[model samples]
Target chain A: MQQSESQSTGAVGARSEQEPSNGEIVRFDQVVKRYGSNVVLNELDFSVAPGERVTLIGPSGSGKTTILRLLMTLESIDGGVIWVNGEPLSHMRRGGKLVKANETHLRRARKSIGMVFQQFNLFPNMSVRKNVTEGPVHSLGVAKDEANQRAEDLLDLVGLSDKIDAHPTQLSGGQQQRVAIARALAMRPQILLLDEVTSALDPELVAGVLDVLRNIAQTTDITMLCVTHEMSFARDVSHRVLMFDEGQVAEEGPPERIFGDPQEERTKSFLKAVLENG
Target chain B: MNWDTEFAISIIPQLLQGLVVTIQATVIGYVVALILGLAVAILRRVDYIGPVVFVVFEFIRTTPVLVQLLFVFALAPPTVAPLTIGISVLGVHYAAYTAEVYRSGIEGVAKGQWEACRALSLPPLRVWGAVVMPQAIRKVIPPLGNYLISMFKDTPYLFAITVPEMMFMAKAIGTEAFRSMEAYTLAGLFFLAVSVPSAVIIRRLERRYAAV
Candidate 1:
């Protein structure tokens, strides 16, 4: 089951030279993560294909966001290896045994992954243009003028072109989040992780942010693994949806099957609960 | 013996010269403190050697700046001047306090900001330089300004090493001309002159940027 699932993940991004064809963009091979005595991800196995939009949804502590955090390398695996583009993210092979990867290794692996957080964590000290331009100019060593142009284009894409000079503190929450979206896309990662990106916004502000994301989903071939409680968004934008239960994927299928005709009792209850609350 | 304008006018040049020395020591020492304090804060935050760095910072912060000055001055080479030693002592001593301020400022930054940098795969240096310090430094400015004022007032301790700072010249002028009242009053005025305006500026800055 796991072998075939991983093989399917490897067959995406056929158009890109940087992204190798038939290589899983991200894979969790029996990954385990623990915080002291509490096991957050229990030997989980999952895979996300290049350009595929996958969403993880469940109750608060079901470890859905942890899946995104782990892929982004924000958290480490306690056991098992996580692969990004068929290379280990949390561990490296040495002398025929798996060993923890070093900082250099983690840094190299992290280049292809970008994450947008729930809080729209824009650099409060920087302007919108600077926040978007910083990663490419600093980390990727892109030319300053080119980075500025790209930032302008991205800010336009997110509908924040007029607000580029404004500091994060000066913008409203929705505008700040759109700027953050532009900031993440400026890095041009093959994989983007969205962890409840609109959860922190006011109810009136949520639609604007969601529209930006849905537009990105329709336009970009960037592989996205999102964790959002917005059920309609999961139904609208995702190619596949996985319902997590206590650190493991309890139900997984295409959105129509998962949301329309869930097989598991747990997934039905979760979807029902979310809709009732919404 | 009386409050004589003639004597005060005669000694004004020496007291002004000493005032220059005092201002120089404060500016130079505060710069050192600011830079060294940031370095110490970074050392404490980074992995490996945290406990040892903690102990070293605590020791420097708890001890008297005057005592540390005397000790570092005694151990100095013949080539180094007393002014330099006094400044170094002032810097290292305040560095301990500023280190704590920096740590809190850095900590005051939301965890999401740090996570954002990690997600972007920014190098550790960029994380601190571009993402972290900009936010942290804004928070630390007010406290650090207070320390600069504190260091300025404490420059009198440099008199113990015969650096000829303001207080030293004041005492020298008093002992020589028996005009203790004018010399001491002039020295006090100089200190208040520098300290009051700076404290006001720092307060205004705090109000201006505190929203961040």
Candidate 2:
């Protein structure tokens, strides 16, 4: 079951890297982020090309998740500019001078991106149907009937069709996470940020969510920036795996090379910890 | 002073009339209190000190209800009216308490929930309306409901304002008819008749919220 999915994902990864590299979907130019005196992302330079699947793997507090959050505009970048789909996302050029993107600009840009949190952050008040359809109907200006149809289809894709009427409380952890994935997909975002999506699920439920994500990575055109601890899933689904340590990319390569023959001591140590613990 | 006979006949009608007035005050005052309390509670969530609202809430909660009732009722003219002032005082007074209930209920919501709402980039007003308020309101149902019943019981205090609510009517009739025992007893019964059922509803709401 896993091998065939991996094969298809490998093909998709190959295609994305080799395709016409016209417009970069996301670019981070010398981004630096800090909290109080603690620096989380230091002089980070990364770019996610259109249709690429980039997996960020690192130990806790390595700022892998922070990168994703910054892109989603949940965290402000203390220094640097981010360009999304050729438009500056972090700052706007006002009168030929750069200024921070205000709330209105950020909201408009963020609407094009969807994030799946590790905790699955489903709106507890909404049933699965409402959760999936809210973004599309409200933010994307999709008609209600069209959004409902899309929601049903996405629910089926996540293998949670029966849960559409159920509240977040009624679903299992994996089921709720699946609903969350569907919720993000509803907006038809240009990029999807998965922050350790399966890390919070139980062992038995992990496979189901991973299955849905594998399908997305293979079949969809959405650019994905994923931070995950699942090394095997990362290897199977990622076009490029970036190993982060101390808030910078310690190593980056195609998954096969990164997993098989890591170049950096920090990368080797992170892999050893992951393997020894797994 | 035909104690038993006068008490039995006059007290029943007077108590009944007083009971009606008491219930009206309780219902109206509680409704105002609940709404105002929720508003104050939500306002407190704002990061800014919110323009002396905290002071006003503290003032109401700290002051004695009897004094407030008298001041509101006696000072206000018929144009302003004792009934309106009386209910406002009761509502705003207990609103301070209800505000606490709301704040606690809001705090009870997991931090994860707020982060999730932000992740979705829900507009601020919708974030409150769609995500935060529902959970906060649900968590607070029990305590707010308790306040409602307590406010109902406190309705008798409005009598000082000459509002002619249940307690005042019973006291008046009891003094004039010289049947204090009967009138007071009937008044107690009137309170029980309303408050007991309201208490039952509050308990049921508490249980339901707890189950969730």
Which ranges of candidate 2 are over 4 A from the true structure?
Answer: A1-22, B1-6, B47-51
i-RMSD per candidate, Å: 0.9, 1.9
Runs in model 1 with CA error above 4 Å? A1-23, A95-97, B77-80
Q: Mind giving the per-residue lDDT tens digits that candidate 2 earns over B6-106?
A: 54774677667767777777788888888888889878767776547888889888889999888777667779867788888988899899888888988
Q: Write the per-residue lDDT of candidate 1 for residues B6-111, one digit (tens) a residue.
A: 8888888998899889989999999999899888988996677877898998999899888998898889996899999999989989889999999999999899
TM-score, A chain, model 2: 0.91
In candidate 1 the C-alpha lDDT for residue A200 amounts to 92
The candidate that achieves the highest TM-score relative to the unseen native structure: 2
DockQ of 1: 0.66
Write out the backbone clash pairs for model 1. Answer: none
- lDDT per residue (tens digit) for residues A1-278 in model 2: 89996674454344333322356889877788999999999988878889999999888999998998898888888976777887778776555445678987887888888989999988888899988887776666789999999999999999998888999999899999999999888888899999999989899999999999999998998999999988899999889999998888899999999999999988898899999999
Q: Which residue pairs clash in candidate 2? A: none
Candidates' C-alpha lDDT? 0.87, 0.83
Evaluate fnat for each of the predicted models and list the values in order.
Answer: 0.79, 0.43
